[model samples]
Target: MAKPTPLNLLADLAQNDTEAATRELGRLQGLRTQAEQQLAALNKYREEYRARMQAMAQDGMTATRWQDYAQFLTSLDGAIRQQGQALAQAEAALLTGRANWQSQKRRQNSFDTLVARAEAREQAAGARREQRANDEYAARLARAASHRQD
Candidate 1:
């Protein structure tokens, strides 16, 4: 855990934002996958139905039966079109989610960089203070030794 400095607080917030974005991206990916699977199944079923209708027609169906098959095929085509639109929307959402995640990640990285630089600066300042104390101690020892000799 980092100390509760302003920089650390900002970094924590950035981390949280990034995590949320990642979760959203995952959800969007799942939706896109589902859409793709559904579309594929619908296409496969439509083709199978068409094949069956062709076979039945070759065997000479009644006019009424023919109309039923043609009407059903039209409905299936509409379903396919609707499914295609859903898939396209899912893809668009996924694309936008990815961009959001990337932006969040970049923001998190920037906060991390700022925190690192601040820590380095603090450490350098501490080192300077220690060096100054050591120099002062040495000078005191030298003066004491000369006083004793006198």
Candidate 2:
């Protein structure tokens, strides 16, 4: 048998598993990053809005205008709270995804190690067989020379 080793199971199965997990991890990272950026943008806008309101209040704002600003700030707070929850969920999902990828990678590495060891053993055995054949040929030549001398 020329290609005797059936050592591609890891590439077929374990590698696929690891690759899928890696992709999942990447998606989760993107989601988490997006959530964080959105939250930061919302917070920054809220800060700027508040500063504007303060300046208007200093210029003697109308009561209706102040009430409108207060209502909008309340809505903004709700949006911020929802965004915070979304970010938390994204963070949790990313953590789980990372763990899954690490586990899959570990399994793939273990299988790769086993395959490497098996190949090494096969190579060593082949070397031993070659050495034996060489030794046998040398012995035969030496015996032939001895017979000739006798």
Q: How many residue pairs clash in each candidate?
A: 0, 0
lDDT of 1 by residue, 79-133 (tens): 9899999999999999999999999999999999999988898889989999999
Among these predictions, the greatest lDDT belongs to 1
lDDT of 2 by residue, 1-150 (tens): 225446656545888999999999999999999999999999999999999999999999999999999999999999999999999999999999999999999998988787878878889999999999999999999999999999
lDDT of each: 0.94, 0.92
Cα-based TM-score, every candidate = 0.95, 0.88
Top-TM-score candidate index: 1
